[model samples]
Target chain A: MIPIVSDLAPLVCGLLLAVTGAGKLFGRRTAQLAANTVLVRVLNDGRRAGLALRAVGAAELAVAAALLAVPGTLLPGVATAVLGAGFTGYLGYARATAPESSCGCSAKAEGPIGVRSFARAGLVLLGGAAAATATDPWWTEAARRPGWSAAFAVAAALLLCAVSADLDHVWLLPLRRLRIRLFGNPLAGAADGPVPVAASVELLEQSVAWQAASPIVRSALLDHWDDEGWRVLRFAGVYEQAARGARPVNVLFALDLGASIDTTSSPAVRVSVIDDDTDEMVPVDLLAGMATRQVLPMAT
Target chain B: MSHRQNDPGRRGLDRRRFLTTAALGGATIVGASALGGLDADAAFAAPMPSLDPAISRSAFAEGRITQIKGSVLEVAGSHGDQHLIQLTNATSIWKLRTTTADQIQVGDGLYARGVDMPDGTIAADAVWVNIVNLYCTVKGIAKDRLHLAHGAQDHAVVGHIVADTTTASYLGGALTSDLSRVRIGQSAQILGAWRPADDAIDIARVTVGH
Candidate 1:
């Protein structure tokens, strides 16, 4: 997973740092721009928030550009990593003590950029520093075989690593976009992309099991049931069909059997849509028996 | 605190996340310090490890080829360190500690271990090539025909000529043929890379998502 993130880290960090640096070098409106975002509302006053935000953005943008341009040689990597370490440390300290904050850096960006928003940038800077500073074993290889053949082989290997890193982002994301454009995915924009019942049934429900994953994943699963769409009606420990043909509505939040509903009495769930004319409780069991499934993809 | 008093979102960035990132970054720098030096002038070179028969023989363990398909071969053994090994048929197999066959096929991704046979022949013992998993992107597709773009280092990937029943969609359209279904945009976690001969790759399994 870390390696996977590393692939995108360079691109995102480089872009962020370059943009941030440019903002600082040029004008103060970057802060003003951040202040206008809804996500930044969590920070209280947008104008004042904008100041810190602008500094951060400018710093990040510079780091990002440096990361890409700087070859992962020993000296350059160490230098860049040092800068990254210091910057991230400062961000960490600020976050730790601050009362409440929005990651004004990407407050306006779409969908799940985790604390990685900062850490990934930091890692790339550091990793690049490490790669740059570390000695290429090829030198030794060539030393053993004093010929152009040895030289060519080492050159090819180094070139491969560099090119792979450069193309990382487009390799995954652009191709996805291209596939979508050329093929026209019917499942486009659907929650979890039209999951088949067989696949959805495989969702791991045990809390202990789920908690083994990264904290970010666990927290997302716990807090955002609205976005998760599918709810756990009842864990019941084992997969028992309430009825053979009854298709359960895949929801994220599980309902406690006796606490939320009477097993024998009252229809399982009561759905009441508030409209101008009607307000009534629809039986949960009735919907559970319905065959068509509705789900919302969990997006943070 | 001053920034916090004015902009509350600044407070939301957790210290834990920041510290973890910072510490990791710091560690990477510290670690790189010990990994030797890289001279930029000599950056482009292939790393040729010094091969000492005595020491190197100990590093490679004996295993048997349990299965063979294409570019992928499966070998089973208790060797703990090596989880996956990728090799071609042109690999020299003559150290007579183990020998299963005189020559493995082109489609065979073999697993064999023996002393570097003086005659370049690994003696009779064990040989295995375990089926491997490849994560790749579908570069092009035809019904039962798939072209994949995969590989790191050399970017060597295989194209699988198999069609899966799962309806894969990319962008906005529903693909009809295997060719139509696979667009240049989607990525897949493929199971096998069946290289019958030459540089061709045949995919075994294609997994997009659950």
Candidate 2:
């Protein structure tokens, strides 16, 4: 029983390493990861980071091969333990010094080193230590007890997936989504309604008034105030009339909260141009005339 | 406030009437006309352009800085295009703070809005270095690092908290450097600098809670 459990440990560890190594060797994101990996950055130059990543991949594959292919050798087990320890140290270093660097443990994984990363490394180390006590290889043990081997393998793979942050979207996210759907989201009523500030901003951006004045608008939501039945949004603008000498102006849009404007509809928002210095409103007719003569013609 | 004197053939005259009336005292009357004017081209003669694409505006370029020669910068865009940005005395360079032209470095991401010269170079008016604003989920947290997941595809990103620059805003609270209250599994909005070579960021501000 002890020998079988010990033998299974190395098999699991070996499989995990093999998958990781494969990703580093031939993943589409390898170049991007290698270029940013703290381990590679600290040890190698810009051009050499790629070569270093490939070397690490090769080393991982070699360890995996020795653990799986070899019958009952303590050497493979010892090597695995050392490699796992090295990974742990590297992750710790990365977390401390280059906190923004990628772990580079998997092809699809671009996350920073976290607690799960440390746990995964520790698991590998423990597996390697268990393998050192085995008298037979996992394959031999599996042949003797096929049913137990299959169950154990399935359990081990599931555990590995649980520990891997990269694989979370496949299992964890679906489970979370299901739980949320069943129990309901805690943040569902955070804003109390569907019409958030972001939604209002989106509505404002989609308005015809925004389209007409976007070229001159210099700021994003400089000031927003709810007045009576309307939401007044302001932005800094430059009055481009040569007579005004490119003077600063305030562009205000009063959006009616009661009116539901569709995307296909013409905007039902009122636009006003206020003189910055005089604090006087520019005549809407004059600005509309200017927009028709200058802005709307440029649109076509 | 009346459009009685204006010709009905004139475009946007009804819109002006509604706006002028709305500004005065007749809010309900303005609302009725505004709703009716929804499909009227005469109300809004200018068409609203589609705003779905993430394309940068004209005279603006967003990319990674590949090379720098004096006041000139060679940028490689995310989309297979290259831009030559020329810095002038008038150009305002901003990283985490307002900085000078000499602070720009290779392997740094950049967003430059400027004038496109006849010779194809952009004479920059404003240059934002490595600026990235992301809404992300805090997947994991360490002593120094925060593992962030961003975008609809859940792209993993690493965010580093700088000592002086990094501040946190909790529940729409004041920005403070004391981030001991930050927890794991919360959604956060990060304003930071994107490291050019990798999928990492140096966070300037992190706003958590709704």
Top candidate (lDDT): 2
lDDT of 2: 0.65
Model 1 docking category: incorrect
List residue ranges in candidate 2 displaced over 4 A. Answer: A25-32, A107-109, A143-148, A185-194, A197-218, A240-247, A260-264, A287-300, B1-210
DockQ of each: 0.01, 0.05
lDDT of 2 by residue, B1-210 (tens): 112212343214453344344333311112111111111111122434424121133367878889999788999999989999987543556665445667789988888766688899987656778888888987665556677888643667899876545666667333455565555568898878777666579887778875
Off by over 4 Å in 1: A1-16, A23-29, A36-45, A57-79, A86-112, A115-119, A124-174, A177-300, B1-210
What TM-score goes with each of the models? 0.24, 0.58
Candidate 1 per-residue C-alpha lDDT over A124-165 given as tens digits, one digit per residue, 9 for 90 to 100: 455555434433332342355456534444553443333232
lDDT of 1 at A284: 29
Give the Cα lDDT of each candidate.
0.35, 0.65
